[model samples]
Target: MPDKPAGMRFKVRNENKNALGGLATRKQITIYFTQAVDAPSMEVLLYLPNHVSGPVPAFAGLNFSGNQSVHPDKGIFMSDRWINNNQKGIQRNRATEASRGSQASRWPVETLLKNGFALVTAYYGDLEPDHADGWQTGIRTSLQQELNLAPDQWGAIGAWAWGMSRIMDYLETEKRINSKQVALTGLSRIGKAAVWAGANDARFALVVSNESGEGGAALARRNYGETIAQLNRSFPHWFSPAYKNYNQAPDKLPVDQHQLLALIAPRPLYVCSAAEDQWADPQGEFLSAVHAGPVYQLYGKTGLGTAQMPAIEKPVGETIGYHIRTGKHDINLYDWQQHLAFAQKHFRKKAKPKT
Candidate 1:
């Protein structure tokens, strides 16, 4: 058996930008950063609560495409970086269209605003689409030399996580946001990125992973759906070259997704899956959550409240939350509903001051 890697520490860094300075006492401020990508640059979607007489909590995630796709907001301009579905950049494995605008409905924006929180998101495509050479064309190109020394230098997953960190940079500039109370979230591949981001940046108060299979919340040793070999062949650029060698040799790999989950220990973490999404291995997802629960327990917080996986549509709550909803491989309103409810239970609700 290979020795597991010790949990690594990371520091967050973002360019100084109070760009939205005075845009609003407490209002939404969206900013676009020009990463090294050729066509479309990256954008940050922000929702700042009406300035409470105090700072408000927030959640962040990586969107699948450009921010424009999220809500069809006329305010969001068309992205030049949009990779054609049949063309390059993992657009080949496009998500179901219905999933779009669906997340907005389930997230209960009003619930969050009323409860004193804000939400922010970034399109992962801007950093590096899940493909070979994705790193050479995106922000990672600029960061290669600095990050290459380490054997586990950031790969596709690291690039996406780095993008999340950049979003954090923008969040810090907003006076209305309590950067200390921010949560990082994502689904599937981006879900994996959220875990990496939260682990690397302690500033992220919470982490939520939904259907992040295999390299995500699932134990690699399980060699379940989306095995290392399949991942490399399908999305060759998402992981380091070192990861490729471990395709059929999970037992020999130094790390498993459970350790990735554990990396978020002592911090609030939630893992969710769908019953029908067997390819993503929902069971493995739940089991990994169960395994990581012990680490959270070490810090005096409840990890998962139980050991057995619950039925679809039935969510078991704990500091380390887990759920298996009825669906396929995609994020649904049901998932967002649970996430909002979970966030409400654990996060502090900052009340707006009297007029």
Candidate 2:
């Protein structure tokens, strides 16, 4: 993995244990660079299971809306970060009071706590807004200057992925979290970021990509659902300039999604898709996982071993898990159920010698 960016600093801005109906403790962490005073700062929200006896494993991801929208907690701060104007409960690129708990269905906090998992998340817009000119207002604008990176060196997705690693850095310093058992996850575009983050950072014990199609888990060569052309047109700022060259000639691209999946070899990776979300190309996502099996075999670990896509609602694979749940392009309790089962198999700490 790439070395942590030099001179990165973290501070606990605010922390409150009495949160989430007394089921979880909330902490807000501020991360910034010591040298880049002008850089935008990142604030991450961590919710630890209050009842856990020890440091609990956590699930980290980028949220589409502000952190307050994840749950109905009056104490949680609402982000002023620029957001997509089209997102639910967001108006004029800002989140209002009505936005709280708007996305609670996707993030089942109580359920995750009951299952012994902490939830760590931050608004993706804090790192980079979802617009072509967003770099001016997000972390990337300052990071590019600090690192002397070219315009094409990285994109919004890369910035979001790097933000995940920074969050991991903070988790490593906290005593209430098992940094080694943290899983990175995302849905849709952020799902793409989760996969890229997992591939670039080995510290994440598990990775889950929910409907991260096209530029995500789906094989780019398949040209099925959202193609390269469509992605570049719709979200040009998501990838590097080099990626756009393959819009019409994907076959000429040196790397495919399988290679990206291979980068997570031996590590437990879960790629989920929805039957009704044809735009994400469920078949291509499964095929990419199947192709990544060889890389896993090199480490004596198994990947999704089947070539044919399994029936809807039936999950498959061992170390590399996948499922095509019967739904649309959204995350739900069913997805969390599968994620918990996968983590239980791979990330659960071993018993203490049966003493």
Candidate 3:
């Protein structure tokens, strides 16, 4: 694969380290997004499982509701986003009725910890909601006036991916983590962020796109279930104004999702889909992965191991990992299992390792 972009090749420094206990050697830092003001304080959540006797690989992702909703842990700050939850966003001073435990089955924290991997997450709503004027409350609010973002710079998708990099800024300080071994992963809309984050940040060792449809892992040109037009129409703030011009006009898109996958190249990337999730276009996702293989070949790393989609629950593991499980549109134990197995295989303990 071609060398990573110069801006993404982050260099490490020695002082970026801290210790919690003798065995729990790690660092934790919070990056404050002081620009946006529609809500209260919003921050990323991180747990360095590397606090064990040795350094460990990690998975970084975006949470849908809020950081506090991911786990019962009190340490995670409550989100300030206008979530659909009864207790928090709706119902005034209470979370939304339909929002409780919505994603518990998706994020298997205990299972992940037992497998010896660190898990870090952030709230996508903290960056920008899927609505118009979201840019007013996102990273775009902090952009330097001198360097105005082209029409594409400050969309909801771009804002969320920018939030992911801010999380990386904190990850670099945690000594317990093999910073270079961190894998970026997400689901649905956040899955799109993960793909963009990995494409933009080379320090992220692996990129996993789980049901990221439309502009995500799916081939945009394929008239899929959730077409580009629907996304732009429903969530006009999600992409730049330039994106709307090509609604239902996939052929005119400067880049398809396959090229987005190619942006990751030699790095490990896992594209997951669900058998029943026709709305997300599973076949389109698989084909995009297949097309990106030529770029991976540049660095002697094979991309997807096959051209045809595999049987349900049949995972194709190679430099590129893929599996279409028998389920609806959501993450589950099966997805986590595949990700852990893949991480262990590629990010195993290095010989005479040095962090």
TM-score winner = 2
Ranking by lDDT: 2, 3, 1
**For model 3, the run of ten residues with the poorest summed lDDT:** 1-10
lDDT of 1 by residue, 1-355 (tens): 0111122122222322222242222233333343223322356666555534577788788776555455533344334453436522324445334324434533444445545667677668777765676666675674444344332455778778877876777778777688888888888888888888888887788899988887888878888878989988888778788888887788898767888888888888889888788878988988888988888878888888899889878888578888888778877667766776777677744333211
TM-score of each: 0.80, 0.95, 0.84
- lDDT value, residue 272 of candidate 2: 96
lDDT of 1: 0.68
Query: Could you give candidate 3's per-residue lDDT for residues 1-355 as a string of tens digits?
Result: 1221122222222111232222222222335433334222236565554335566678888887776666654344556566544333345433443444446677776666556677777677766655576567555564424225543555778778877876777677766677888889999988987898889888899999999988899998997789999988888877778888898688888889999999998899999999999989999999999999989988998888789889999999699999999989999888888887787778874232111
By descending TM-score, how would the candidates be arranged? 2, 3, 1
Lowest-sum lDDT 10-residue window in model 1: 1-10
TM-score quality measure for candidate 3: 0.84
Stretches of candidate 1 exceeding 4 Å from the true structure:
1-41, 51-53, 84-111, 145-152, 350-355
lDDT per residue, candidate 2, 1-355, as tens digits?
2345688888788888888778888899878854466546777888998988888899999898889889988888888877777777788889988888889999988888877789999998888888898777666666665666754677898888888988898999989999999999999999999999999999999999999999899999999999999999998899988888999999888989989988988899999999999999999999999999999999998788777789988899988999999979999988988888888789754322110
Each model's total of backbone clashes: 1, 0, 13
**What C-alpha lDDT do the candidate models reach, one value each?**
0.68, 0.87, 0.72
